[model samples]
Target: MRQHSTSTHLAQKSSWTHPIYTKKQILDVQTAHRKASSWQDRVALSTVKVLRWGMDFVTGYGTYSPISISVPKTRTMTEQKWLTRFIFLESVAGVPGMVAGMLRHLKSIRMMRRDHGWIETLLEEAYNERMHLLTFLKLAEPTWTMRCMVLGAQWVFFSGFSLAYLISPQICHRFVGYLEEEAVITYSKAIKDFDDGHLPLWEKLEAPEMAIKYWQMPENNRCMRSLLLYVRADEANHRDVNHTLGNLNQTDPNPFAAKPKIEIGLPQLQQNGRVKD
Candidate 1:
């Protein structure tokens, strides 16, 4: 077989393929979202922040910190190679780093005085993230089934919330910001590199919506050419909620506005990788 190039592979697309966006495309979207902000728009944001940070910290949940992760583990093989890849890369690098911090946050919930409602609400969501992570593990390890853990990451998006809750919800959004914006590179590479051009039946369901919604919009903005455009959008929304809440404390809101543009390059596949826009 001829050696296929990464650029050639990414550029090659079928008729049904989705549009891809670049860093500039995302900045354009930011320009649009920037104008839509208002004081009244901040109400829900302030409530979420205050509840997440203030009352929840002081009265509701308890004092919380961040989560942490464990060391990488030795792996056993399975019929599905991709699952092993997911486990090795995502579970090891992706989760442990983010989740360790979230664990600390969970432990912090113990410091709270209780008396506040929404503990169940919080737990339910937390449970959802756990479930998603479990599914992620399944996807990564493929000890049982087949699926791209990239899709799993999308479905397991609640990991963002877990991150948020792990830290003071106020500042937690800062971490959420990382997941939303920075994480795309991880998932994007997963999609780009893992596409061996074959997927099993059950794997189809894992991250169907993400594959469709993120990539298949009418705006001609997706092509899987760049993952940061859409993934960063996800981070922006999480931060928007938090930034708006900053208004209550008279702190400067609108974080991404000033956030120095993080450059989006090509997939860092290996020592052989080259930067692409």
Candidate 2:
């Protein structure tokens, strides 16, 4: 029999803890995030996406911030509920600045900018990747509260990272864009490994801590994971905007290191030893 690393705690978590959830449960989360029967929910979700995009771009760096910053994270039951519920925000945020791209793309779709067609598709692709984080967190964190911390830490990281861009758009944005692209790839592959049922203890730590945990973990694969892919894809969309602006960074002279390969629907754990939603 295969030596299941989680065998010891798996039953423990399954009994009182929520089942790790199969793909279906994960998909339910995706559906909750994407679809809204009520216009209010739809409007709220869209508003949240757009607003966070603006705030993150204006401040967040699309990278992990240090723990020293004031990010408003707290420890409480309500906080825990919010942690699990709001985790979707962080997952969607893997591709920092993506919602802005979509909004921008939509704004210019009629203008017929030179890169309009590909650029819009770029943002849409990135948006899809941003949504993958909901499932990847299972591998990254054991509890919902930790998930919020992970999400908040990314915000803090991006807060600092964006400062570089704010200070010097020409040089800093260029370098930062490249860094975000790398983050995209790195985080995407992270989704894959985490989802594959590796490293539970490490994941239980908060996002701020996971930043280091990710660094400590041995390389299980070359990719950043599906979650990160969404991140990079979004950055790619953001970069596409640079070419259109009358700015120094029209495009990376070096171009992408490797063509982005995005895949959806990775295998997930079965619930109750049977694959049923």
Candidate 3:
């Protein structure tokens, strides 16, 4: 039996069974995918920001300060800066779903009524966000200070979202929807920066092993930009789902069914991944 050379294997792997794209193509698609296309879309996005601002005001001193200090300017968010942002961002991101799920579970038990599948879905969302945190853990080790910040941020956000969820789940869900919208924008910028020659570090970086496993990304096609795209798509799905829930009446059919699927095409590159747009 003839042994194949490494280049032979790699060439075979890189053969385009699917459409391959350049960095520009992926970035263009992501921007287009997340763009708010119409007047109503624009208004709704503005409203989300305003509502989130109000919510942030309630705990702004605590939550906003850490974010402001941690996340660098978009052009400056190199791998380390972005990973630091993810450490804190993901810690807080995992909170709302767990709090909402736990509260819904108790509400259902006390009322002796089924929870309309909310408990399971919310718990799943929580777990997914936790997975995001875990994936980032493989990419960056937080300093002791960053670890303390994560602990502090999680405690405050958990308390705030829990109370808000208990008082008015609509606001709680809307808050998360808005948060996810911001996440979508953040990831898109990261991808753009990397593609545009700003994040030189990305050229030398491989996608985290956990990210590849979680997204079922091709092993031969793994890069930091691909991971960002996948994670952004996840956030976009969460954004749409929570927004739909916020707009619904309690009797709405199949809330879980309303969530949008991710839909971003992955490049057939040496290190790229696919995301459901």
Best by TM-score: 3
Regarding lDDT, does 1 or 3 come out ahead?
3
Residues 40-112 of candidate 2: C-alpha lDDT, one tens digit per residue = 3344345445545654443222322234323243311122232343244444344434533443455456665
Give Cα-based local distance difference scores for all models. 0.34, 0.35, 0.63
RMSD of 3: 12.0
2 or 3, greater by TM-score: 3
Error of 3 at 266 (Å): 31
RMSD (Cα, Å) of candidate 1?
18.1
Worst 10 residues of 1 by lDDT: 261-270
Q: How far out, in Å, is residue 251 in model 2?
A: 9.8
Ranking, lDDT, top scorer first? 3, 2, 1
Residue-wise C-alpha lDDT for candidate 1, range 1-277, written one tens digit per residue: 0121222223233333333544566555442122214443344345334423431222112111124222122221122333343232333223322443345445547665331222232222333233333433433334333244345544454465455444444444333333223233333433433343223322223332333342444334333323323544433443343333223221222222212311211122122221110
lDDT of 3 at 164: 64
Show model 2 residue runs off by greater than 4 Å. 1-93, 109-115, 138-144, 150-177, 180-277
Q: Compared to the true structure, candidate 2 yields what TM-score?
A: 0.30
lDDT of 3 at 132: 88
